[model samples]
Target: MAVVDHAPGSGHRTAGDPGGPGPRGLGRIGAVPPRRRIDPADGLAAVTAWRTASDGSPPPRPVLATAVRWTLAELADRYPGGACEVRVPPFGVVQCIPGPRHTRGTPPNVVETDADTWLALATGRTTWADAVATGRVSASGERADLSGLLPLE
Candidate 1:
């Protein structure tokens, strides 16, 4: 199964795993605030009402989820690397960073974090090293240092 950063109400790991790469090998940025559970229905309703009043048009179907999926896909494609891969639900793996290709089981490098954290990093709100140091991200491999190619913003 594809790795997912967010899973309903289950909180993610807050500390980076030691068995993998070292902490903040890149540089310190900031930590992402933990997210609270949001009722899908309630969120959908709020978005729908806001859209209708704001644009006088019907709300898009599951627009939030769709947007998240799109965001994941865009990032995955933007940072393609044969050694590493970004995982988010609804959007699959994307080859980023042109390099020696890997066609085996485990990739040489990999960085996995939650959807919120990923979004924050993508939007220039967070840093890869900071997230990894705070245990918000789990990364491995030599070239897995994604500090340079982040916050696609």
Candidate 2:
């Protein structure tokens, strides 16, 4: 299973378990904390500013978080599948691409990266191949390549 900061707080203590690292340490077998719904429109403003900034600097934390989650949601909506799990820690995670869905344990296809890299990929600021070459992404499984569906601007 993926261990992401977006799942829950670091202290993963569960009732009836002392915590040893497993389902018990995770607070539940395969449960993730609910994500805070962010309106994409709100993020669009920040993204626009970020894209055109003279300094090429990122937006503030809240704004960046909004953008990351919105982009992840947009990707999920576009792909509409559970074959690949894309994760951006401290911000978002989404299941996308079309193929077989995993019912238990770690998914066969997974793509994990930081929010900055994800935003770059979601927008047209960077390419999948470039990010992969630069080691900005960790993609596993055949369906994890998202180049076809990116530049989602």
Candidate 3:
């Protein structure tokens, strides 16, 4: 599953892009979020809201953002390092895995995905292979694969 980089606002849409199955997201701009510590409790609450919204609608942006950041933070703690960069855009980004840390330019290993896909994968609702196969995730460079470390239970 190789996804090439596209310019910002390139209008590139994956099979089940940011909005996922339904009209989940109106539209979104992908960007790195500021670094912050998100309590796992807050994160879990937001994720729960996203998963059990009943209306089949996504949680509010900030709430969803919290979920994204919390999972990313958890991942970082699990595999502490600067080897890989995981991006769930317009929400959060985190450096993770154990490998050579990039001191300049972009990190070699990078994983990028929409908030919906990220939420699904992060919480075990979806698997890494499935997301890649469906083009719901973009991964590049060595060490980018996060198949072994996911579904943050």
Q: lDDT tens string, model 3, 43-105?
A: 889889888862487778888888888888899999999999999889888889888998678
Query: What TM-score quantifies how close candidate 1 is to the native fold?
Result: 0.52
The order of the candidates by lDDT, greatest first, is 3, 2, 1
Provide C-alpha RMSD values for all models, in order.
16.5, 9.0, 15.2
How big is the RMSD of model 3? 15.2
Worst 10 residues of 2 by lDDT: 12-21
lDDT of each: 0.58, 0.81, 0.83
Cα deviation at 81, candidate 2, in Å, is: 0.3
lDDT of 2 by residue, 1-153 (tens): 865443345665434444544556545666565666666678687676656652576567877777788889889988899999999998878898888998678999999999888888988888999999999999999999998999897
Model 2 segments more than 4 A misplaced: 1-37, 52-57
Would you estimate the TM-scores of all the predictions? 0.52, 0.72, 0.74
Q: Which candidate is the best by lDDT?
A: 3
Total clashes, candidate 3?
0
* Candidate 3 local distance difference test against the native: 0.83
Query: For every model in order, what is the number of clashing pairs?
Result: 8, 0, 0
Off by over 4 Å in 3: 1-35
